[model samples]
Target: MTVTDTEVSGRRYTVHNPATGAEIGTVPDCGPDDARAAVDAAAAALPGWAGRTAYERSAVLHRAHGLMLERAGDLARLMTIEQGKPLRAARNEVGYAADFLSWYAEEAKRVYGTLIPSPRSDQRLLALRQPVGVVAAITPWNYPISMITRKVAPAVAAGCTIVLKPAEQTPLCAIEVFRILHDAGLPAGVATLLTTSDPAPVGDVLLDDHRVRKLTFTGSTEIGRALAARAAATMKRVSLELGGHAPFVVFDDADPKHAAKGAALVKFLNAGQACICPNRIYVQRGILEPFLETLVARVAGMRVGDGLADGVAVGPLIDEAALAKMERQVADARAKGAEVLLGGARATGDDLAAGHFFQPTVLTGITRDMDIYHEETFGPIAPVIPFDTEAEVVELANDTRYGLASYVYTRDLDRAVRVAEQLQFGIVGVNDINPTAAAAPFGGVKDSGLGREGGPAGIEEYLDTKLVGISVAR
Candidate 1:
């Protein structure tokens, strides 16, 4: 009952560690009334928070940034327990989360307005940026802490009060973030945090209320679409960071070992639950053999176990559903003539028996018929599909409905620039595996989602432009 079931009469939902299948904590099952109250609190705090000088708000955010780094160790450990990423990776995520707060602190002061040239000497025209008011931010479970800061920091920096609902599986991480913000001198009611297993009631309140001026969400595309539709009812400003079927293209000129090394590093990150992790890796046919050899060797070296264990390169999948999805993808691939180049099944060991553990798998001979080729595999499975030419590869890569992220590795500058430009993805990495940063725009085009986060573009999402004209006294 503590971690398995959501009872009808129970007021709380328990959170369990996927690494060990043990109960970690419980959170209240918030409903419509709690959501309404949160909106009220945020609305009441808006004028005061928004009225503060950008310098004053920046000071608070700067303090929060410092606190995040000072308490990073505890935060990382807590993330490892709740989100199941390896300890080292969790530490990196905490640092990444802190950078957003730091970046937005500077941006708070940089929210500039412009004075337009007037047609008449006696008249003045001005363009100003104003806070959009209360925001509804919903975050997913993966990279729990980072997602919160990515959305919440920018909104608060723009002087918008927020009501955030963290994913049910990771409320404690959100609670910790609120604590840091409060300690950093953020006024009460400026940010309201809600925990809920039944999200429909809360979601309804957020989308239906005109008081919640904006809605920001990070999750799957299916749910993102639904939320966007709901937000349309009230014309709320919406930002959705949804699913990605990313492609990693490796040209023949690139070193096979280098490409494989980068592939292995990013593919198994958070056990590949990340949206931007490459779903399909396209290596030129001339160099496919060497790349496959190196990739298999590196993939075989990955150690899958509990996140707290030292030297564990890969951690457990979030739950049984994720583990089953991984198995089903592999099963579908094998049934349709895909070859398993490396670990293809669940990690079987006494230590991992209780948890949802999947071995890092590599599949070759991927065809259009295989489920892994057409579907988004948010798990530790790398499907390497060989292509003959740059043109063919680009076509294959861009065939999916998603256009969030893409990667290209090439020694030839011409090919790198050409392929990156023609790829049609929002974020493209040239000879790089990771393309995310606090001061860089991050989002997608097409069905991937709408709006951007991180960098200067992020804070803009929480602001509305106001135009003013005045006639001077004659």
Candidate 2:
């Protein structure tokens, strides 16, 4: 939609449409000066924002949520055109994003502190959670709206100001979200967005700015590492939601059809670009063949086209680089003797071939040594491996450096609970494929990330604990 951010006055960067490789918008490639300005604005606004009562902040966010609901369709369409997710999935993301605003709005007023009695009868101690000052939220492009909402909701709820830098590819959604919140009575300078293509510069600016007391990021592990290192220098509070190679395990007691459906749903959602999407599948030998057959049939049935197209199950990858990466992974797996059970070819059609379209692919016979099995395949590709024993499968699933999310399907509740405990991921799903919810804590362990994103735990990321003591005299 040609969203240019000349309004902010900075370096220019183009946003391209993944489905067509066309420039949909141009935003300011904000530099250090712009970042400094944003930080100054946030700092200027913090005093008043922090002085407002929790109910006041909650009221503003609630109004923002109402605005989001009214414009949900428009935001979803923008996400589809800019982010290359199916229309239905884009709509779902908008709804999910709105839910974060609503959930955190109520959570804002519920920030609870506790009192502890001292051994001495005259002394009492109070523990309180306070806002962590200015927050620098760097979000990814996959779920632009939700990622921003996830970070901003908590920060705002905690009475903290924020300077957000959204991914260059999908900054429009976040910009629009900020605008909506601003319109919903968010005080000027309480929140600001800085768009920049160079992440290094942004990270440096955010790290160097003393006004920025915290940094929250969602992206690649390498970038997360760099940001963490930089933030550590400043001793800024950091919350990272990094890379993942989640395992989707199907036990012998699983329903083949159900497992196949779950695999298809999770693998193709957001073109499998989500950090927590199930990329690696470990199926028990008993139902391996039937599960593979069902998965192949379902993948073959998916309609690959533009995200804006009605009923399109699969959309283009974010860009040519992502498409090339997926192709290389598929080729490497095939070269190492992995069987192509379903679709494996790059898409070719009148308009589809010109874009970043790729068919939903399934690979079997993948071993532990292959890159596709161990690495994160952030595309619409699923690789299935057969395991003989529960212990062996659990070990294999935990072998990767990432421990973001894991899935298991079993009718036996005891076995499901045992396997769930054995898995080292932050979020585990037994029968349901959808593990992410507004009410549940979502994050990762190890290299996947540090800190949580959802539920009550999410609010803690934006808060700082302080203890106060009072003595009573007789």
Candidate 3:
């Protein structure tokens, strides 16, 4: 067994690429003890790492950002092989992840505290932000590199040492991140990567430990709820980026071709594994036919094959479970009388037969009673529904329990502002499919998860506030 193969209790889990079903590598099956050890290491490094001036920490992060850019190609290749996203998309993700590290590096020096005026003459009151100590950061497999960096960058920027628990399927990418930071002169134990197939032991140990002060997780809403409940006992500060049932609303004034193409691009990104991808679309009845035609044309143009292939656009789902789930949702929608406008089943080409490939599908005539209407179809399936009025569409959009992200396309300025304000989603895209950046806040409200990430709000999640007062009266 190689170093990558961490044998814990004589069990090793092998990771394979869903795009081609090829064995990528194996990692250590870490247990509770290993998890605890990672926390201890972080704790041991906390004081030294946190004691440094913000400038010093910023320097290290900047160096890491530089390293990330320099090695982006290798990193992107590794990510594509492990996560099964197209090579172009993987490259973009690597660059985006580097942006987070670079942005937070500068933001670290700007974690400003405020001073307050006291009612009395001789009293002075001030507020200061302090590091939250060791952090337990858990990231999911989809967009593995970006998710880990998004959490890790801010935590480190806030002067908090962290132990990253990356999803089992994408441990190598996480390990590569650590390697880059280590090369950038980040002290050992300041950042640790713990790879494990069984997360229960690690989660239990982290939640039980007082040394771990903050927990940030990116995953499904069900798991997010369980983690939040478990951490409630310890009262650890938590940030959860959970599930999203996003909606893309296109008005009659909008260009049907542009809107349709944008929808297809966003929906098919990462094979629609993104939490914020447009889950449901509400187009004005007048433009529905044109939108559907353009959307089908775009969907039909997408190439589903190995991620490494030059012209391939759509890659495989992460695993058999995801493939089965996509199948069920399609079948459920069909049973409820939804029309399959285009490809509705798995791709049958010889090139994609061994992989977990699903064809990009378009559906119409869907009703609220259908599973595709409410359930998160985290696959390459577009369910388009028609709406008559703005009020009716807004009502339909806000009906879901999730409020992560939403999109709107229209020429009316008043309507755009009105609808965007009325929507309950955390992030809104106006004539845009992508709403994410390092300088902007990312996260959602309601069941989509609590708190925020990115922008100034992100670093705040890793910090605690303290108020101090001084009075001198003789």
Candidate 4:
């Protein structure tokens, strides 16, 4: 069973498990008409949803969060089948996804209006927050459930209807989320989920439709820009969490072993598929060797196999294209003389042969000329670069156009604060690898895209501020 009995957009398409090269299931191959229908449904439902009191909407989101927790194991298994993260990671993600619903459920009631003192007697000034009408959300394959929940939860919690187009590769997991929402008493048409192999037509309709007042996207920067451009025609509110080439910086004062362990753990989380994962690790020249050695040994001991397998710390890449991309990046680095200190080739075993597996890899002597240093390596490969001074490391880290998440490791309070302030990235983790939470804002500056997600600001992305002024009639 899936989210709805809504008729397919002409046909259905197969969804495969990247871990096994096997078909898990099929979903509706939604297209333009489906997109239009979803938007129309959302627009129609917006008034009723928006008219509801904050408490009323909060009730539904709270119910959904509870249901998510109850069905977590099932959802996690489904995620592993389609999205291919380790089962443990999938379970954790399920909780994280539910956290958004819980967070926004409370945030709903906290959407307070402001009353301002009028300049003249008998005059009144007020600021109000209201739902931004219909929302069109597009989420990526990586972190499918949380991405959807973050967008959908806030929009619904803010009393807005939504039309979600989850990535084709991981639509099944999204279906389960939609089903949970529906069962949680979300009114029909208040939330529409369109699973599709072809997104161009759907995205086109969503962007072109005037009914969609807001567009929230979590995917590639290229696609986000294109969508934002088209959405401009309708003056749609846009929020984008795009591609990241996050740099993990370690200063000389930092514990080399601790920093390396942190690097290995974070760099391999989700098999390095996360947008926040470090693309480049910069270590102070004094501690570079120890960091590299610890990083190499730890990553070398890590296990890689099917996400469902016992003790498998890492899982397969999403598909052959991802594997090929990792191969090319590593090849480019090797050709440029970077040392491959650990596994640098595709993992091959009878159990892993059919999967899109890449061995956890580590490379040192990374230079600006290497592709891994420049491009975001969305795989289990860690590239280490050495730096001498804070100014030099900060410059090297901020060299990329992307300014999403970045990390810095140092025991010195002044250095931690200084480097974090100097680094031109959003959501810097000073001595902490995972700084994201339901209460803190997550976004980027520069080409990393615009607007913010999570925290109190997340719901604001789905809200519009209105001002009211009254003049004396006497």
- What is the C-alpha lDDT profile of model 3 across 1-474, one tens digit per residue? 111234234556788999888898977778877776787778988999999899999999999999999999999999989999999999999999999999999999999998999998999999999999999989999989989889989998899999888998898898898888889988878888888888888789888898888889999999999999988888899999999999999999999999999999999999999998999989999998899989999889999988889999999999999999889999998998998998889888778888998999999989989988888889999999999999999999999999999999999999999999999999999998998899999999999999999999999999999999999694
Residue lDDT tens for model 2, 1-474: 111233344468889888988889877777777777788889988999999999999999899999999999999999999998998998899888988888889889889999987898988899998999999989999999999999899899989999888988898887889888877899888888887788677668889987799999999998899889888888999999999999999999989889989988998888888887888898999998899888888888899999998779999898889989888998889999998887777888997976898889999889877889878999999998889999999998999899898999999999999999999999898888788877678899999899998889999999998999989896
- The lDDT leader among the candidates is 1
Best by TM-score: 4
As for model 2, its CA RMSD to the true structure in angstroms is 2.0
Candidate 3 local distance difference test against the native? 0.90
Residue 163 CA error for candidate 2 (Å)? 0.7
TM-score of each: 0.97, 0.97, 0.97, 0.98
- The deviation in Å at residue 153 for candidate 1 is 0.8
Error of 2 at 153 (Å): 0.5
Write down the lDDT of every candidate, Cα atoms only: 0.91, 0.87, 0.90, 0.90
RMSD of each: 3.0, 2.0, 1.9, 1.3
Estimate, for each residue in 302-328, the C-alpha lDDT of model 1 and write its tens digit: 999999999999999989999899999
Backbone clash pairs for candidate 2 read 11-29
Candidate 1 lDDT (Cα, 0 to 1): 0.91
